[model samples]
Target: MKFRKATSENVQAIVEMIADDPLGSKRENYTIPLPKTYYDAFERIDADPNQELIVVENDIGQVIAVFQMTFIPYLTYQGGIRAQIEGVRVHKDHRGLGIGKTIFHWAIQRAKERNAHVLQLTTDKKRPDAIRFYESLGFNASHEGMKMHF
Candidate 1:
């Protein structure tokens, strides 16, 4: 498998894998010739030095997993940088092949390379399986995450 920053060609596959999940199915419009908004967002992320949209490809060069990482400069923690992981997804066919763990290992190493003091992510409480998988990767439920939909 290969991991790399995503390109325009990867946006569709990434959205498809994201929408395959329960919550993303409600929020993402995954379609042939996806909405321009998706491409626009990708462009913005691509231009930002602190943002990384990553994809994992199989041996034959098919995108099978994806995640977005953002590095934020914080005034707290001694003016440190925090890495946030989001939108992680693995194609349903490749779920049990340890791709998730491998992808996370890559993310963690990337965070360390960026000199981030901490790496954090929030998963919807409804996704118990996701929470368990994250815990297996050494994440702890140390804080209660709350959000208000706009």
Candidate 2:
């Protein structure tokens, strides 16, 4: 599999994968066209130098996975940068094939290249399996993450 930056065209596939899950089905309305918010976010991500919205594709060139990794500069950790990853998803057909591990491994190396002192991500408390998957790859639950949706 190969990884590449997600272009405007890949957004639909990415959202579809996200919606395939029970939790996402209620959130993503795929019965019709995707909402404009997704497009807006895509445009914003494309403009941000620190944000990397990436997609993974198979040898056949089919987009199968998606994630966004952001490199945030900060004064913490002796001024070292931090790499934050989110929206990680693998297509149902591609699950259980080590693609998630490959994505994480690549993100770690990318973080190191950018001089990130730490690589971080937050998974929903409901996703115990995902948390365990992350732990298997050396991520720790060092902090509690909270968010307020608009």
Candidate 3:
């Protein structure tokens, strides 16, 4: 498998993988012609220097996973960069193939390459398996994460 920045052509596949999950199915509109919002969000991410929207492809060049990494410059860490990963999803057909670990290793190395002081992510409380997987990767639940949705 190969990791690369996601292109416009890969948006649909990415969204499909994302929506394959129960949580995502509740939120994402995965349709024949996906909503304009998805493309617009992709364009914004593509343009941002601090954001990397990525796709993982199989040997045959089929998209098998998707994730986004955001590097935030912070005053709290003495002007350090904090790498935040979100929206990670592996295609339903490709689960349990170690692709998740592979992509995470890639993301971690990428974060280090960018001089990030810490790499962080949040998994929904509902996904115990995801939490365990992240723990296996050496992440800790260091802080309580809270969010408000409008």
Model 1 global lDDT (CA atoms, 0 to 1) = 0.94
Candidate No. with top TM-score: 3
TM for every model, in the order presented, reads 0.97, 0.94, 0.98
The residue ranges of model 3 lying beyond 4 angstroms of the native Cα positions read none
What is the C-alpha lDDT profile of model 3 across 15-61, one tens digit per residue?
A: 89888988999999999899999999999999999999999999999
RMSD of each: 0.8, 1.2, 0.6
What are the per-model numbers of colliding residue pairs?
0, 0, 0
Task: Please write out the lDDT profile of model 1 over residues 31-88, one tens digit for every residue.
Answer: 8989999999999999999999999999999999999999999899999999999999
- Model 2 lDDT per residue over 49-72, tens place: 999999999999999999999999
Model 1 is weakest, by summed lDDT over 10 consecutive residues, at 15-24
- Candidate ranking (lDDT, best to worst): 3, 1, 2
Residue range with the least summed lDDT across 10 consecutive positions in model 2: 25-34
Compared with the true structure, all predictions reach lDDT values of 0.94, 0.92, 0.95
* Candidate scoring better on TM-score of 1 and 3: 3
State which candidate has the highest lDDT.
3
Q: Following a full C-alpha superposition, what root-mean-square deviation does model 2 have from the true structure?
A: 1.2
Whichever of 2 and 3 has more lDDT, that candidate is 3
